[model samples]
Every structure is written in structure tokens, then in C-alpha cells.
Target chain A: MRYVLIGAGPAGVVAAETLRKADPGGDILLLGDEPEPPYSRMALPYFLVGTIDEAGTYLRKSETHYDDLGITFRHARAVRIDPAGKTVALEGGESVAYDRLMIATGSRTQRPPIPGIDLPGVHPCWTLADSREIVRRAAPDSRVVLMGAGFIGCIVLESLIKRGVKPTVVEMADRMVPRMMNAAAGGLIKKWCATKGIEVLTSTKVTAIEDTGEARDPLRVLLDRGAPLRAALVVVATGVRPNIAFLEGSGIETDFGIRVDSHLKSSVDDVYAAGDVAQGPDFMGGWSVHAIQPTAVEHGRIAALNMADGNASYQGSLAMNVLDTAGLVSSSFGQWQGVESGESVERMDEARFRYTRLEFDGERLVGAICLGRTDQIGMLRGLIQSRVRLGDWKARLMEDPQRISEAYVASTHK
Target chain B: MLKSLHIDPGKCTLCMQCEMACSYENEGLFNPAKSRIKVFDFHDRFVPYTCTQCAEAWCMSACPVDAISVDHATGAKVVSDDLCVGCKVCTIACPFGTVNYNHDTGKVIKCDLCGGQPACAEACPTGAIAYVDSDWTGYDKMRRWAGKTDSGAAQAHA
Candidate 1:
């Protein structure tokens, strides 16, 4: 059986590797749209920080890694996929047949509706090309404007700062990293960023980016709540949406992202979707596209196993966000928004930037958010994911949430 | 020059992000018990424990089947999981107590620095954990020693 994997990002690369290992005799074809070798997008920050070169971002270091595994790597974008015939048509009218199809096309950066967004000085910090463009313009003391202060934006913020650019970050949210962090946690992050010399404008939006008509530095950005800022380069890290446009009317179901079942199989036969593009089940018992790398890896592994062996099933994915903004770390784990009637407890030290908010439903921890309290993150994640009852320890946790490690040890020791 | 994970107990906030990242990289799952890097919390401070990739290299000397070998690129002692016999000899031989056995894989596992780019160091938000030149671990300990000796301007002015 020939297995065709699309979009050679983390999901596709892992899928191809998993498939090759699972079925050595099967024909495996991995297609990537980019010209570069299959690299980890997660390592893009490391690349921008000069710790590693562009080649270091590659998933496999050896040039002949794919060839040695007998997995064919092709550089092509899938324009259309016909699940009925299991044929994928490429951009140049080329078609490839496969017995099993893995859709791991990943995501694309979202472009907000703002005037002058298509200008030369403006770009998205998503791909290697964008990183190169950013490094070129974001020289030391260069005025860089980042449009969003969300998750991806904060990640890029570190790289931009490390590159010695004093970036003016503009976010529409009331606080930074709103999606991953709560109001208080997000506010603390914003304060930390301001302390680190980054000009953060919360509750602000970029209305337009006008050209200064200069060749060297030519961008003047207009904001909703602030003064017009001069910019050498404006990075629009607004957000990302899955690449599911091609699957429209292709008989596959899509809700924000391509819909896949527990087995990572699409609605149609033998066709599967994984990674950012797949709307798989959430650990909370719903469905959503988790664009995180860990989830994508799990999706790829399980999806590959299911396709090759058809005995594996996914237990759903938990929404886990671990972020570092200029050295202040914060994380959110599973249903952090809290369940109704759940007992919530918080310990905040705004002065020290240390905080922890635990949400417990009856006897089990449904969610948790910790700012400056990162060491307890692993235990909190285990507690939430395992859905283990806090039992008599629940009272102690309610009394002092900082005793999470004790609780974890006590409950699991037996 | 080779580098090692220099962990400052005081700098750690006990996030355990390093542990999760290490476990995921080595075990393909986010299981902390499976994690090579263990973060011990003593309430007053947090200490992150992991393989030192030791200069003396006791684990290397203890390995009988030669499963534990140094990765030439990273100067890390990476265990060849395929060749390991699960004897647990290195686990006892290592003075630092970093190397341990993995019951799931029936092989010993430890931090291999992720083949030079350690996920633990990369995942660490604070400078609590750093992959610095082994020769320079003393540099952080005596941070301003050279500056004091050279000019003595900042401290000598008093």
C-alpha cells in the first residue's frame, strides 16, 4: 500500500517516519510545499536568535536521513485531493495515487483587515522566509512593530528582542497572551514585558501602516489607541488558521479545520488528517484544532499507527500552552477557563510576579494557570490529564494550592 | 568546546517544563517519571537534577555492552537503546545518580543533550538551566571576577 503524506512540517515528517518504521515494504511519499528541507517550525525562534543556523531547524540532521529510510520526499503543494479515487493533484497538474492519505498540511498566518498590510515593509513571522526577512530589517536599535501580542507573537517577541530590536507591540486584547492566559496572568505578563523595555500597548489595534515614502525606513503605523509609530519593519503575527481551503467540496467535512475521528481518519475512506489542520477531539470531550507542536506529534504518531495497523486510537488532545515572555514564564493547562460551580482558588503576588490559580470540580482539578510558578506545571498537567480525585488531599489543596507537589506525590505514591 | 547543563537551584521556579520536554523527546510521551531531567522542589528553592555529561564519565566506564557511548557532536553520553541489555550497571556506577533505568523500554535513559541541542535547556525560560561551555561553568559562579581584577573601577571607587 502506498501512503501519501502532505505538508512536510512536524506532523508530516513524523508521520512519514512512523509509517516507514511501521510498514517498511509499503510505498511512502512525503510532499512539502516549501523548498527547504523539512524543518521544525518550533525551532524558528532558535534560528532567529543565532543559536542555530537555518539547517539546524531541520527535523533530521543528516541530509540522507529520508533517503536512508526509503521515504520519498517531494516538494509540491496539493491543490486538490479526491478522496474517492485516493488521488492528490498537485499545483502543476500532477497527480499521485495512494492507498492511505495523510493530510498534515498545517496552518498559515492570518492577515488582519488593515490598510497597507500588503506593503513591502510588513510581513508575517511564520516561515523561514519570514524569519530571514525579519532578521534583515530588525537590526540593532531598528524600530520594529509587532501587530499581535498573543502566543505566537510573544514567542517571536523573544527572538526579535534577542536580535536587539526594541519592538513596539500592539495587541487588541485588554492584556497580552489573552487566549492562553487569564486576565490577571495576562496583565502580569504585560507588566513584565514593559519592565523589559518593550513598549506594550494593550487594548490597542493597528488601523493602518502607511508608507513614509522613504527607501530605507518607510513604514508609519496608525494605531487605534496610540500615536502613529515609525517602523522599519512591521511583523503581523495576528494568528494562524489551518490550511483547509483545498478540502472544500472535496466531500470531507471541515469545521475551522479538517474534521477527523478518534482514529485520525477523515469522513471519507482511508483518508486521514492530523496536526494543525485536523479538528480532532479535545481532552475536555469536544473538538478543536490544537495548533501546538506536542499535539501535532501525538496526532501524527497515533494517526500513522491507525493507518498502518488500524488498532490504535487517540484519547483526544489537551490544550497545553507554555510560554516565555522576556524570561517570565507562564502556562495554562486544560479547561483553564474553569467549569461552572467549580471551586476556584488563587494566590497572586503582583509585586513578585508569582501567581497560581487552580480550578477544581468537586474533587478533581479541571484546570490550572500558574504565572512565575513553572516548576509545579508538570504536576498540574498530570493531575488535570489523569483526572484523578484529590480525595482527602482536596481539602489541603483548597487550603493551600502551593502544596500541589505533595498532593501529586501522595496520590501517586501508592 | 563541549557544554553541560548548568542548573542554578535558586533560579528554578519548579515549572517542570524541562522535565516534560525531556520525557517527550526521549519517551515520545509527556510522562514525568519517564523524564530524564528531574526537578526536585524543597519549597524554599527548586533544584533541577539531570545527567552532567560528566568529564570523568563514570557511566561510560561502567557500561559493559558499550551501549552508553559519547555522541561526538554534543560530547553527550547517549545510550544506544537497541544495544542496551538493561543491566542497570551504569545506574549504580554514576556518582551523580543521573543515569537510571526505563522499565518501559527495558533500557537505561538519561539526558543526551538532545544531540547537542537539549530540549531542557531550550525549554527553560529562565537562565536557571543553561548549556554553557563546560570550561566556563566557573564563569557564572564568579561572574565579575575578571572585571574586578582588570579595572576594579566599580568596586574600587568606594
Candidate 2:
């Protein structure tokens, strides 16, 4: 059997490895668009901070990992996939026939249609190439204007601080990580950044970026409100959308992303989807795109299992985001925003920048948000994923949200 | 034969010998805070917890850099300190909360079962922790039950 996986991101690389393990005799081909080795985009921030080199960003450290597994990894981009013909048309006029195909083409950075966004100093902190440019331009004590204080924006902020750059974060949303974090949590993050001397402008938009016609400080960032900020570089962290333009008219059902079933199978036969591009089942109930790495990894494994003829079903992707903004760690899991008619409990110590909020759907914990706490945080995911009835522990947790470890042990052990 | 750590929390007396041993063996320090294995006090009881070395390890799979790998000799999912970029993705990915980030070193750390001879099992004063057969961790209990139900019919047949 010939197996073909497009996009050599985490999901694609994992799917390729899993397929090799599951079907040792099957012919596997992995296609990546970039010229570099299959690397983790998540590691780009670390790379920008000079914590790790480019080699450290690679998914597998060994150069011949894929070759040793007998998986042919080629640097090629899939322009179109003919589901009916079971063939994938490449960019350079080549078609590869496949018995099983995996659409793991991950999301691309969403470039907002702001004027002068294509300026030399203005760049999105998405790929390794972007990080290289950012590293060269973002000098110590240099003023850097950061756009979009979302999850990626917060991460880039941390990297910028590590590089000793004066960062001014501008978010169009009311708070930082508005999509993932609640108002209180987001406000706390902004306060924490302020304490660290990082300027975070919430509920603000970048109207335009103008070239200053200077070599050192080359960009002028015009905001919707307040005075225009001059900076050496401007980083865009707007967001990302699924790379599903090629899947258009391919008979694959798409709503925001290519819709997949519980088995990660696409609308077409002998084809599957995983990672950011697949709008798979959400842990809460309906279908939603979970663009997190954990979800992508889980989706890849499950999809590979199903592709190998092994009966496996995905339990849906949980929305989980963990961010470190200039030394303050924050995490939100599942439905952080409380569901309709659901009871919620919160404990905030703004002085210490410690906070915990738990959302409950009846007796079970449906969601949680934690800040400045890392001890046994995974228990939150465990408790939420297990869907174990908290019983009396629910009341106990409502009284003290910090008793999560105790509650998890009590509920799960029983 | 492949061996695994069989932990009997019921036999534990909360001596914290396992923690010290684990920290000393891995980190070259006798600090329980730096220990990979932790003994959590639950007000009434203390339970020693560490990596169970899952068959389908989530920490290994969720690692973006493939830093976590299974030790061929021990079957323990070990994190390469050099390769781990300290992303902490494994810390959140682990459902059991075994993998933890070491702030001092800026890398994630987890139980590696002490290569093959587990320090926690060796240091346990009471036999609460034991490195036994991976497949037959309950063989001793099963043997005890067999001894309890021993009848002369088996001897007669033999």
C-alpha cells in the first residue's frame, strides 16, 4: 500500500512515523513545502530567543530518521489533490498516486490587510525564516512594535523580552489572549507584563505601518488610538487560518477547515485529515478547529491508526493553551468560558499574580484557567478529559479552587 | 527479562527515601524538590507517584522536537536533556502529570526508571516499590492466592 502525507509539520511527521510503525511494508511518502528539514513551528519562539539553534527546531534530531524508517520525505508542495483519481498534483507538474492520503497541511499566518504590512521591517513571527529575520533586526534595547496580543503574540512577547527588546504589544481585542483567556485572566496577564516593564496596549489595533526611511529604526506603527510608535521592527501575530485553499472543489466538506469524522476520515474515500486543517470533533460537543499542538499530535496518531486499518476513534480535541509571557505562566483548558447555565468558581490573588478559575457542567469540571501555577496542572486536563463526577469534591473545589490536586486524586482514585 | 517498577502505595510509610534516592541518582543531589518521583501527602495518606512508562506514551508523542524517547533497555520514556528545548509541551501533554519542567536547567525532566535498576525500588525500606517483571507485576500476589487455594487434588494428579 502506498501512503502519502502532505505538509511536514508535527502532524505530518508524526503521521508518517506512525504509518511506518503500523505498516512496515507499506510505501510511505512525506511531502514538505519548506526547503529545511521537518521542524516544529512551535519552537520558532525559542529559536528567536537564542535558546536553541535551527538544528534544535527539527522534529527529529537524527538527519536520516525518516530514511531509516524507509519513509521517503520529499521537498514538494501539493497544489491540488484529486480525491476521485487518488492522485496529488505537485507544484512542479508532478502527480503522485496514493492508496491512502493524509491532508496535514497546517495553518498559515493570517496577514491582516493593513497598509504597509509588506514593509521590510514588518514580518510575522511564524516560520524559521521569519525568526532569522527577527533575530537580526530585533537588537537589545531596541523598540519593537508587536501586533495582536493573542496566544502567539504573548509567546513572541516573552521571546522579545528575553532578547532584551522594548516591546509594545498592540491587541485589537479587549484583553490579551482574548480567544483563549477570560477577561480577568487576560487583565492579570496585562498587569504582569506591565510589572515587567513591557508595554501592552489592549483594545487597540494597528492602523498602518509606515516605513520611516531610516536604516536603524525603519518602521512607524500607526495605531487606531494614541500616538504612532516608532520602532526598529514590527512583528505581526494576528492569527492563522487552515491551509485548505488547495482542497477547494475537491468534494471535501469544509467549514472553516476540512471537516472530519470521529475517525479523522475526510468526506472523500481513502482520504483523511488531521492537525490544524481538519475541523474535527470538539471535546465539548460539536465540531471545531483546535489549532493547538497537543490536538495536532493526537489527531495525527489517531488518523494514522485508522489509515492503517486499525479501528481507532478520536475522543475529540480539547482546547488547551499554555503561555509564558515574560516569566508569568498561564494556561486554559477546554471550555474556559463557562457553558450556558454552568456554575463557575474563581480564586484570584492579583497581588501575587496567582489565579484559578474552574467551570463546571453539573458535577464534572468542563473547563479551567490557571495563572502563575504549574504544580500538577496536568491534573486539570486529566479531570476534564476523564469527565469523572466530582460529587462532594465539587463543593470542596468551589470553596477552594487550589484544591485541584486533592480533588483530582479523590475523584480519580475512587 | 524486561522489568518495571511495581509500586505498592499501601506498604509505603512516607519515609521519603525514594525521593532522595531518585534525586541523587538523576540530579546528583539529595533534594526531594528536584526528585523525579514525588510522594504527595493527601492529609491522611501519602502516595508516591512517578511516570508509569505508558505503552502509548503521550509525553513522547506530544513532544514537538521528538526529545522524549523510549529507553530500549528499560522501556522507560526518557527525555533527552540536551535536545529538550524546555517548551513544556510534554508537561501539559502528560495526562498523569509525571513529566515536569526543571526551572533550574531550563529543561523538562521525568522518571527514567534509573536506566534499569530503579533507585526508588532499591531505596524503599519496606518493599513498597519493587522492580519486577514487566508483564507479571502481579505474579507474587497471584502466587500467594494460589498458595491459599492449594488443594491435594493437584498433587494427586501430578
Candidate 3:
């Protein structure tokens, strides 16, 4: 059987490798939108920081790795797919047939509707192409105006700040990283950026970017309620939406993304979805598109297994985010926002900027977050993932949550 | 069957407890500079990394003196100091940078995982570093996600 996989990102790469392992004789074709080799989007920031060259961004080092695996790699944008015909239509009007298909198209940055947003000075920090442009323009002392202080924005903030470019971040949200962190954690991040000489403007809006002067003059980024900020470059990192627009008319189910079942198979037979583009059921009961690398890799593996090995099932995905904003480390895990009537315990050292908040539904920890104090992160995940009953130790945890090791031991033994 | 040290970077807090425990146990000191299991502080992420005891074992392959060998029971690539030439060939060959030269000992060293009971895992306050079955480190995560697909809220939502 020939397996055709789209989007050569983390999920696609893993899926291709997995198919080779499961069925060596089967033909595999991996398609990517870009001209470069199958590189990792996660390593783009490292490339931006000059820690490693563009070669370091590749998911696999050896040039012949794919050739050795007997996996065919093609650089083509899949414009449409025909589930009925069991084929994928590429941009050049070429089509390929397959017995099994995997959609791992991943995601693209959502461009905000604003005037002058498409000017030469503006860019989004997403693909390797964007990184290349950013590296060219965002030199030292190159006044950069970053839009969106969410997870992606904060990450870009670090790379921009490292290049000695004092960036003025503008976010509509009341705090930085509103989705990944709580108000307190967000406040801590803003303060940390301030200490590091980066200006963070929460509850702020960028009205328009106007270029009236000569080529050398910086663009004037007009704000709603403040003076226009002069910026050499404007980075749009507002948010990301899955690349499922092409899946229309394909008869594949899609809600937030391409919906897949317990086995990572889509509603359409012989077709599967994984990565950011695939919206699979959540371990917490609904469905979500967890675009994180680890989750996507797992999705690819499981999808390939079921497509080939036949009895593999997908449980669900856990929502997890780990961030290192500048120097202050922060992390959040499943249901961290807390459920109704869930008992919670927190320890805050305002002076040290250290905090821990644990959410418990009866004896089970539903979610937790940590800022500065990063202890028992894995144990917390273990407890929540396994839904281990804390038993009487729940009361002890309520008294003091620092004894998570003790809690892990006690709960696991029971 | 050998056991494995599972590393979940998402759970690391940059506490450096793993480094301290590793140094104390292996080097008889509390210096982080001497620890074998290095925690990469990427600023935005703190990922504690060490030798993965690769199935293809590059360090062992590059060992000119046949000093590097795999422990059959644990799957960890161990170095015999007496046989090592201290040429730093393994250090250069390791793709993950887990292998390092101990200038004081005139030999290269990496995490032996403390003879299967990793002190780094024990000292980790956050369960980011765990020792589990070598064959399946993702079993816990899989089981957890599976549990969520079971009764109650899952069925209700379905």
C-alpha cells in the first residue's frame, strides 16, 4: 500500500518514519510547502538567535536519511484532496494516489486586518522564510514593535531582545501570554521583561502602520491612545489557525481542525490527520488542536500505526505549555484555569517572584501552574495523567503542596 | 530488558537539584560543572539532557581503544577509564553532546544512570527526569490520555 502524507513538519516527518518501520515495502511520499528540507519549526528561534545555522533547523541531519528510508520527499503545496478518489492534488496540477493518506498540514500565522500591515518592514515569525527576513531587518538598535504578547510573541520577544533590539511589545490582552499563563504569571513576565530593558504594553492596540518618509526612515506605528511609536520592523504574531481550508469538499470532518477518532483516523475511511492541523479529542473530554511538538509527534506515530499495524488507538491529548520568558521560567498543565468548586492551594513569594498553584478536584489534581518554583512538574503530570487518587494525602497537600514527591509516592503505591 | 531514564523537559523547573545530585553521586562533589547529566537552560525552556544510550551507540563506535561498551542489562554506554585514551574523540562524535571529558581524571564520562537507579531522577523535585522501562517511556502519557477517553465526562461528551 502507498501512504501519501502532507505537510513535512514534525507530525509528517514522524508519520513517514513510522510507516517505513511498520511496512518497509510500502511506498511513502512526504510533501512540504517550502523549498527547504523537512526542518523543525521549533528550531527556528534557535536559528534566529544564531545559535546554529540553517542546517541545524533540519529535523534530520543526514541528507540521504529519507532516501535511505525509501521515503520520497517532495516540495509541493497541496491545494486540494479527493478522499473518494484516494488522491491529493498539488499546486502544479499534479496528483498522487495512495491507499492511505495522512493530513499533517500544520498551521500558519493569522494575519490581523490592519492598514499597512503588508509593508516591507512587517513580518510574521513563523516559517524559515519569515526567520530569514527577521534576521535581516531586526539588527541591533533596530526599533522593533511586536504585536501579540501570547506564547509565540513572547518567544519572538526573546530572540529579538537578544539581538540588542529594544522591542516595544503591544498586546490587546490585559497581560502577557494570556492563554498560557494566569494574570499573576503574566504580570511577573511583564515585570521580568521590564527588568531586562524590554518595554511591554498590555491593554494596548496598534491602530495602523504608516510609511510616509523616505526608505531610511522608520515606519510610524500609530497607537489608539498614545503617541506613534517609530519602529524599524513590526512583527505580527497575533495567533495561529490550522491549515484545513483545503480540506473542504474532501468529505473529511473538521471543526476546529480535521477531526480524528481514537485511532487517529478521520471520519473518511483510509484517511487520517495529525499535528496542528488535526483536531483530535482531548483527554479532558472535548476536542482540541494541541500544536505542540511532542503531542504532534505522538499523533503521527499513532496515526501511522493504525494505518499500517491495525489495532492502535489514540487516547487523547493533554494541554500543556512550558515557557521560559527571558529568564523567569513558567509552566502550566491541564485544566490549570481550575474547574468549578475545585479546591486549590497556592504559595506565593511576591518578593522572589516565585509561585505555585495546584488545582484539585477532590483527591485528584486537575491542573497546576508554577512560576519560578518549578518542582515536581513531572510528578504533577503523572498524578493528573493517571488520575491517581491522593486519598488522605489530599488534606496534607492542602496544608502544604511542596511535598509533591511524598504525594506521588503515596498515591502511586496505593 | 534494560530500564530507561525518561526525560520530560516540560516538567523541568531549572532547580539544578538533578545536577547537584549527579555531581555528588558520581564525582563526590556538589559542583554543577562536574555533573554528567546537563540541564540545557535555553532561557525559554530548561531541558535536562544526557546520553539516550542510543541503540546505534556512536560513542562506543568511535572509541579507538574499545574503552566504551554498552551495559547489557541497562543499555547504558559505559566507559572504562583504564582503557580510555582521553583523546576526546567520543566527546566530538556524540551528536547530543552528552559525552564530556573530565580534565581532572584524564578520561571522558557520561551518565551511567547511576547503575540503573539514577540519582538525578531521585533528586528531581519535579518528576521531569524519571527512570522507567527502556522499551516504552511514553506508556504513562498514553495510559493517562487513554483514561480520559474512558467513562464519565468522556462518554457524556461523546
Off by over 4 Å in 1: B1-158
The docking quality of candidate 1, as DockQ, is 0.03
Q: Taking the tens digit of each residue's C-alpha lDDT, what string does model 2 give over A157-192?
A: 889999999899999989999998999999999999
Taking the tens digit of each residue's C-alpha lDDT, what string does model 1 give over A1-414?
Answer: 899999898788878977887788989999999999997676677678886678867766679989999999999999999988889999989999999999999999999988999998799988999889888888888889999998888988988898998799999989899889999899899899878989999899899989989865579999887589988999998999999999887999998998999889999989999999999988788998989765777678778877886456666777777666887877787878899888989888999998888999999988888887544355665577657788988998888888876676455432
Q: Compute the interface RMSD for candidate 2.
A: 12.2
> What DockQ would candidate 2 receive versus the native complex?
0.24
Report the C-alpha lDDT of model 1 over B1-158, residue by residue, as the tens digit: 87777877768898999999898887798988888887876567677766666543546544434466788888889887755544454553443446766555546777799988888888989878898888766324222322211111122123
CAPRI class of candidate 2? acceptable
DockQ of each: 0.03, 0.24, 0.06
Identify the candidate with maximal DockQ: 2
Query: In candidate 3 chain A, what residue range of length 10 has the lowest lDDT sum?
Result: A373-382
C-alpha TM-scores of all predictions: 0.75, 0.94, 0.78
Q: Give candidate 2 regions above 4 Å deviation.
A: B138-158
Q: Give the winner by lDDT: 2 or 3.
A: 2
**What ranking emerges by TM-score with the best candidate at the front?**
2, 3, 1
**lDDT of model 2 at position A188:** 97
In candidate 3, stretches whose alpha carbon ends up further than 4 angstroms from where it belongs are A214-217, B1-21, B24-158
